[model samples]
Target: MDLQKQLNEDMKQAMKNREKQRLVVIRSVKSALQNEQINKGSDLTEEEVLTVLNREMKQRKESLHEFENANRDDLVAKVEAEMDVLHTYLPEQLSDEELQKIVDETIAETGASSKAEMGKVMGAIMPKVKGKADGGQVNRLVLQSLS
Candidate 1:
């Protein structure tokens, strides 16, 4: 099933199963997708939907970190659960070796020979890595290879 239909089915299942937290996260995801569609005045592609899911997952991870620092186990658990739900919609994550290989190829493709050309390399890499790899790790590996 496409993501929108899959999300709708999951939302219905969550409601019927009385999964309050799961239902809430699914609803928030639907709302974000709807807002994006309306803003752009078109239906979202699978890749576009994945972008929204990744953004939500990233936000929850950041929240989870703050909750951990505050020793709020309750909130931490909730955010983690939300992140778990979000993960179901993202593309399979890239392994470090796989990511490093892609970064190296992009560096060569962009003719980026040093740290000074990091912007060119990054611009070329982000499109390929979007929703599949973490930006920070990508940046770090790019710097390591360049340096």
Candidate 2:
């Protein structure tokens, strides 16, 4: 099913099951997607939907980190739960090995021989790995490859 349809179905299920945390996370994601649609004045394609999901996940991860640093176990648990809910929608993440392989191929293809060409390498790689790999991990691998 398309993500929007699946989200609607899950939202109904969450309501019926009284899964409060799941419901809240789903509603927030739906709200974010709706806001993006309004800003663009168009319905989102699947790729755009994934972009929104990734953005939400990134936000959750950042919050999770901050909560951990602040020693707020309660907030950390809540953000972790939200991250778990968001993970259900994202495509399976790339393994480090798989991402490294792709980075190597992209560097070779783009003739990016040094760190100075990192931008060129990243521009070519992001679309291929979008929604599957974390940007920081990709950046680390590219830097490792270049140096």
Candidate 3:
């Protein structure tokens, strides 16, 4: 099933099972997808769905960090729960070593020799790593390799 349909089905199951937290997260995801469709005036491809999922996951991660820093553990826990539900749709992330290898290859492929070429390397690498690795991780790897 497509990601949106699967999410809807999971939302139904969550409601049936009386999983309030899970249902909330699923419904939020569904609402986001629907909003995107309406705004874009088209159906989302699987990759587009993944992009939306990743964006939401990133937002949750940032919120979690902020909440933790503010010592709002209760809010942190809630964001963490939502993050867990969002992550179920993401692809498996690359390990540090694997990410480094790809960075190296991208640098080589793009002939990027210094930090100034960071953009070139990133542009070349992001498509290969998108939905599989976090942007901050990828940027760090690229910087480390380039520097």
Best by TM-score: 2
Give each model a TM-score: 0.96, 0.99, 0.97
By summed lDDT, the worst window of 10 consecutive residues in model 2 runs over 60-69
Model 3 CA deviation exceeding 4 Å by range: none
lDDT of 2 by residue, 1-147 (tens): 999999999999999999999999999999999999999999999999999999999999999899999999999999999999999999999999999999999999999999999999999999999999999999999999999
The root-mean-square deviation over C-alpha atoms between each candidate and the true structure, in angstroms, is 1.0, 0.4, 0.8
- Model 2 ranges with Cα > 4 A deviation: none
Indicate whether candidate 1 or candidate 2 has the larger TM-score: 2
What is residue 138's positional error in candidate 2, in angstroms? 0.2
lDDT of 1: 0.93
Query: Taking the tens digit of each residue's C-alpha lDDT, what string does model 1 give over 1-147?
Result: 999999999999999999998999999999999999999899999989988888888889889999999999999988988888888888899999999999999998999998999999999999999989999999999999999
Which is the winner by lDDT between candidate 1 and candidate 2? 2
Report clash pairs, candidate 3: none
lDDT of 2 at 47: 99
